[model samples]
Target: MLGAMSSIKVQCVIKEKNEIGESPVWEEKDSSLVYVDITGQKVSRWSSLTGQLDSIATENLVGSVVPRKGGGYVIAEGTRFSFVDWVKRSFSTVAHLDKEKPNTRFNDGKVDPAGRFFAGTMGLELRPAVVERKQGSLYSLHPDHSVVHHFDQVDISNGLDWSLDHRVFYYIDSLAYKVEAFDYNIQTGGLSNRRVVYKVEEDDGIPDGMCIDAEGKLWVACYNGGRVLRIDPQTGTQLQKVKLPVQKTTSCCFGGKDYSDLYVTSAYKGMDENALPKEPEAGCIFKVTGLGVKGIPPYSYTG
Candidate 1:
């Protein structure tokens, strides 16, 4: 079944059923989509035009995957930031964190406008929805291969994107149920003047991965709400919404020839045995079209 948006068409593009699918990145070079399967411990690249999907398995939980400016890709897995060699299908650690907390692991992340990779971690997940502590922190990996700790005590560092002017950084710590913006200094990679842009009501579900459109509006994925909301950051008003057949809409990115297509990721990790039967497309990747909007290209990690 398609979503409630009558004018918008939502189709399942990938039916691989990732355990915990997150982080969808559009690779314009090859017209492919790159994403991660956290609990599945792998990064996958799928060609929407050809329907060819290739995956590289990692040794630990892989949270996010983004293209590197030099080559291959950068991944946030376990407690470290690693480089994924596309040709060799291997990983090389570049930076590590949370040495003392064995339960914490890297989560959602993305590259900034300046090519710095910003990724964060989450506390121990006792189960699908039960996260234990707030020991996770947000960090940035510079092009020079240096890691900078931005802040601490983040429960689930998820969505991240910078404003068009590169002066504001938008982020989401899922458990907070709100979107926060920081005054960003592009040159120094510094953040200040943090403020709330909008709040995600409990009924709407936890806000997960996010992206910004050319119009400066935000597109946020509602984890258990089965919807993607287009919100105006300044007024906290919902401009539009695209519903999905599945509930766990993890993350979203703009792709396609003109960057007008919205690609969304989902998960089936915590669904009960009985509940899983009803949502057959829970772990699939969806492509939403007819939205009549274009998105900005994502930045790659220069390092």
Candidate 2:
């Protein structure tokens, strides 16, 4: 258990609600924030400079969105990894993962510092009266079009990031309620020596998406907890907490000119009618400023 820090104020930047908002990424090149709405089946861009919001509809449930080195975006749709030319609304499949299990869908993902795209899947039974299974797995897609299985039996593979030095890798399995660390090899894309680095108590909410700050602190979104927490990975202690007006805080990332604005995404996918009125702002994108800290720019996929 970790002590709570003072609450910080957050403001809604985008009011266009999403069914399940996740994967908030800052496109430094265009000074915009890009994210996906899984259930809504859309990828959105919110420009900070012009206050413009644009969206491209997808035929499948889009999991994550990250910038490509040259242009376009690498996205995880269902079990397929694909590249999307947002400007033209065109997409091409890169690879199909876990094709045998149609019940699984790609979830949270990001590119490593070495420019490899890593995404994971979770058992998502969409049919009524179907029970979900723990058949999720994490994988890394190299620039050369190679896929490597990193972990298996993940119930809900979510947040992922590496330390500033790139020697330590941190991951979150929402169902496990713990942040796990691994010894990372930047050159080979190898993760070993896995161990629990931080645990979220049941009351604090389940951990989902995460981002590392310039100071090396891990900021995690607490799903159904209505807050984003900052923790010291080295000591596994909670350093601070930023309360949000909504309950389902899905993911977060740092953006803005100096990378000082923390952009957060939320969800209203599972909220009941009674819960909706209490959290009217549920599904809106949020931003927290004045943290007096910065985050490292996310690496774009070279492939």
RMSD of each: 2.3, 2.7
Per-residue error for 137 in candidate 2, Å, reads 0.3
Q: TM-score of every model?
A: 0.97, 0.95
The candidate that achieves the highest lDDT relative to the unseen native structure: 1
**Which parts of model 2 have CA positions greater than 4 angstroms off?**
1-7, 98-100, 125-131
Expressed as tens digits, the lDDT of each residue in 9-89 for candidate 2 is: 489999999998999999887899999999899999999889899999987988899889989999988988899898799
- Runs of candidate 1 with Cα error greater than 4 angstroms are 1-5, 98-100
Indicate which candidate wins on TM-score. 1
Task: Supply the TM-score for candidate 1.
Answer: 0.97
